[model samples]
Target: MKVLVYWAAVVVALALVAAAGGGQVAMAAVRCSPAELSSCASAITTASPPSRLCCRKLREQKPCLCNYLKNPTLGKFVNTPNARKVAAACRTPFPKC
Candidate 1:
């Protein structure tokens, strides 16, 4: 569990870096890895409020959200009502995708 959360945080971070839009430099730094969103899994899967870490990662990964939503493997999870609640709790806007 800890390991998963750790990986998820990393993913969100990468997405954040990419969204930062530093041009090529930023793109290189961006990861957009879905694994990084692991930290939010528990909150999104359960009724628990999102943790600070989860919220932070959600913010960081905000740019990659649309891609995640478009992904067949991950779209379902990202589109869930629970996921929306988690996003709301974290103050991260849910992607239109």
Candidate 2:
């Protein structure tokens, strides 16, 4: 009986870990498009908080931030104070791009 209880607890712990891991994987797979970013840029530049869809795009584009920051033309938009403000408003940490 003791062994059965221990095994049950172990299985429960493993299941919880697997569920959390799957959530992270799902988030990581999210993606964004140029149109999505453009839709949010104006509001972001004006210091308005980004909408839910805009914030979702931002997270989806997280992997591209550094690359975008390296472009002379795009860098201006990504490196602005307004961009940071929007990111903060969305509760998403800005990537160190």
Candidate 3:
């Protein structure tokens, strides 16, 4: 469908923009879903390097890090040293929350 194609294009564009630069994507329409962090999970749980997608998602989700930390279920995971390392690697600085 046209709508699906358009949305897919938008996603690809956003990803491309994110991968090509650092900091926020300048799109406040960012989805605040914590599940987006899944891209960084393997790196967060181990010593592996974060993929481009992982860094992109982390940058996109920077605005929501405090909220994620406020979540009891996600708090523990977000607070780990490994998680911080992943964020640092992504250049997505771990929030002070």
Q: Candidate 2 regions off by >4 Å?
A: 1-33
Q: Give residue 87's error in model 2 in angstroms.
A: 0.9
In order of TM-score, best first, we have 1, 3, 2
lDDT of 3 by residue, 12-97 (tens): 55455335542133347875666667677667666589999999999988887887677665566678888888889888878986
Candidate 1 lDDT over 1-97, as tens digits, reads 7756664664565466446542113233565666567777777766689889889888877887777777564676678898899999888878885
- In candidate 1, position 18 carries an lDDT of 40
The model with the greater TM-score, 2 or 3, is 3
Better model by lDDT: candidate 1 vs candidate 2? 1
RMSD of 2: 18.0
lDDT of each: 0.70, 0.60, 0.70
State model 1's lDDT: 0.70
Which of 2 and 3 is ahead in lDDT? Answer: 3
Q: Which pairs in model 2 have colliding backbones?
A: none
Per model, state how many residue pairs clash: 3, 0, 0
Residues 4-97 of candidate 2: C-alpha lDDT, one tens digit per residue: 5553554454345334542122235643223336546555545666888888778777765665566554566678888888878777787874
